[model samples]
Target: MAEEGISPSRQGRPSMTSSMRSSSFLREHQQYRPPSKPENHYGIDTVVEDLQATSIAPPRQISPFNGIPSPENPPVIVESGVSHELSHPNCTPVPGTTSFDRLVATLFYKSTSPRVSNAIPSPIRIPSPPKRAKSPTPHTESEIPPNMSPSSSLDTFPLEPPTTEPEPLDHLYGSYISPMCITSFLHLMSTFPLPPGSTDLNSAHRCLKLDTAHGHHPLVVELTMAPAPSLDYLSLSDLRKHELIYRFEREWNVDVVLRSDTLWRRYPRLVVFDMDSTLITQEVIDLLAATINDPPDLAARVSDITHRAMLGELEFDSAFRERVKLLTGLPGSIFNELRPVLDVTNGVRPLLRALKRLGVKTAVLSGGFLPLTSWLAGELGLDYAHANEVVIDEATGRLTGEVKGRIVGKERKRELLLEIAKKEGVSLDQVVAVGDGANDLLMMEAAGLGVAWNAKPRVQMEAGARLNGDSLLDLLYLFGFGDEEIRTLTR
Candidate 1:
């Protein structure tokens, strides 16, 4: 056998046959590399064929900085195991390192390692991601409770059972009802023992969601309960039960009012409002108390009493007297100063304007003195204004600290509401009362719809409905008026 070494060729040049064999040995023992093209997919057979057919090419010195093939040695394109040499293009080369260079280096150059298997490792079997959980249904069909006990929290009036079949609910003043609120309220109602008239808690209830222009949500929903002669206002007492209503109000922070759903309730002939805190932001008595500086902090002391009176902690008559006694020496001219400065509650002007446009008669029944109430009534174009009279001493030119006429306490407020309703020839069921204190509760109860406007806790508990929202304009919503409708009416 011939010596396994470089032998002299015919041209006196050392033969490269031995060096070629060494290169092949090195490549076979080198670490296996993957394909250059990311898109190239190879089975085990393809990988093995590629490894076997790859030819060793002459080493080309690639610039470390540019990673470009030298001009003397151009790129080799392999097609079907056949090498085709091509010159580098004249155009600017790709900026970054490419996979072709890497492939060429791997096939031609040798690294110190044993030959790697040609078989492609089993393709990674990644588990598919888990399915997402389904969301709960928005409205669940609530089951009616067996025993519907009457709530005993409110002093509700005796509602005469309908001797005739219940009337059709045509004129319904529906408001946007929360599904959560309705669901929760129904759940609460389930706790009550089934009253005689109501068939099932869920039987006659209807809920609808409609798109509206006025509210932020733009979606208006109304919950309509079937009329039940036995269950009035969801109360327990045969005499007066406000428990369920109060619990609903306290728990949900939303009012639960049961209406007669009559045309009269829908288009009320008269709407009465408490002047202080309801129409105007400040209590007129509290403002009058500020005029007395001789007692030093008399305004502060009287305001405390006024607060107590509004909260039902003190009797309105006695509290009025006490607060008035503090204002005995205050000048009547102080009313003038208070007139311009009195901050009206938000949305008052718009609400009144809308009510007037709707052909509804409006009134102000204030616990405050007549001067402010009458002035406010005149300013707001109210049809009627009733309030307590303050006796002014003609000689002293100051307040006498005595009421001239009958004190307009809780009973008087209710009386005034009834009187105004009668005077307008409007039925008692066609009157709407809105107020913010304990004194207003009686008036609110007597009216067809009694709205507690951001009232005391006790008042909120007792009133037919309570609204704690920011704007008085929201009252229009209770009348089943959309934003666009209210705008048109007001305009």
Candidate 2:
């Protein structure tokens, strides 16, 4: 049997084969037996009798062949009239058996035996083993099964999902400190009473404490909160008051308090204008170009480039050079002829008169040729004029296409604002700057108030306030002027 069919178990003992007696025993057990008249039957009977005489059971069938009885055993005999030659040819003896196989065979044989059918027990289903908890120690090479390598085990079971935790509150707060948080903290401090005999208000003390903890100067913190009522009682008798007042003045300048019904009361100061595009509808260069043999496209391109430069996209010098290059050989006489056609912007006369009557010294600061700026300034009765002088070729009387004086870029404009303020004996806070270009950013920054009139988006973002939907005369509203004052000034 050991030399016959292989056992299913990977590890087991060799198989055992019973002698011929076992075959005879099996044949005797069966009701039909071979007939004595057949010689083949006689041979089979002799073999079965010989196996039976040896007192051993027949070997269990393995496959279809090799089911012949052994020659030794003779105690068990075959029945008559059964054919031995007709057994299945493919049967073979079971081989390499183990205790497990023996148990399986016992169950199988008992189930098939007719005599043991009544005694056959019901299948006892073994319960599956409970799962064991994983050990804390990590598995190493020795712990894994023989068929499963480390890589194979890793493929079988993936890593556990990562655990995520919320960011700490301090880290989140450090990343983004809301303005509302500051206001809320101030409000919270206002709820507490001031310490006895302390001149400092509770809110001011809280601010000081916060500043001290954060290593910021107490005076700077006080200066920042000076406008609030919470810090009103703090002494401002020293130069600190002047600083605070200056700060307040700058803040008040940007705020359009004219609509507050307190403009004249809060700030009584001067106003200024830019002649081209600011006070007038026409740009002097475009006006000159429109009178030339040049197409309207030239004027449009110059204006568009000028507009973009003012909004801070291209550099002022670059835009100016590009624009001037387009008008390189044009006659200077074009300026003289187009002067009369320069259109005045809407609300100019009224806004000018309103500012004049309000005792606001009005001026015109222009990047246009002085001739055009001066003519417009005189026509409008403006108090002062500042503009570039256009150079002319001496022999041809044609335009040189170059400015003679300072090119009023942002820095020069800022200088002009400061110079005007100093010469007029007023602080920068007393002056109001209005313009619609990138070159005006410095001037706007210098003045106490900056008004962006129908300005580009960039100018609007940087300017203190914008006037898109309203007339220039609406500037009076910032001074707290009403419709009555407007009418009076115009009249």
Leading candidate by lDDT: 1
Clashes of 1: 13
Q: Worst lDDT window (10 residues) for model 1?
A: 101-110
Best by TM-score: 1
lDDT (C-alpha, whole model) for all candidates: 0.66, 0.56
Q: lDDT for model 1, on a 0 to 1 scale? A: 0.66
Question: Lowest-scoring 10 consecutive residues by lDDT in candidate 2?
Answer: 101-110
Candidate 1 wrongly placed segments (more than 4 Å): 1-182, 186-220, 227-253
Residues 109-206 of candidate 2: C-alpha lDDT, one tens digit per residue:
01111121122233445443346865566434343333333455567553543232222222223212223333433443344333344444322211
Compute each candidate's TM-score over C-alphas.
0.57, 0.47
Taking every candidate in turn, the Cα RMSD to the unseen true structure, in Å, is 28.9, 43.2
Model 2 residue 286 distance off true place after TM-score fit, in angstroms: 2.2
Q: Report the Cα lDDT for residue 296, model 1.
A: 88
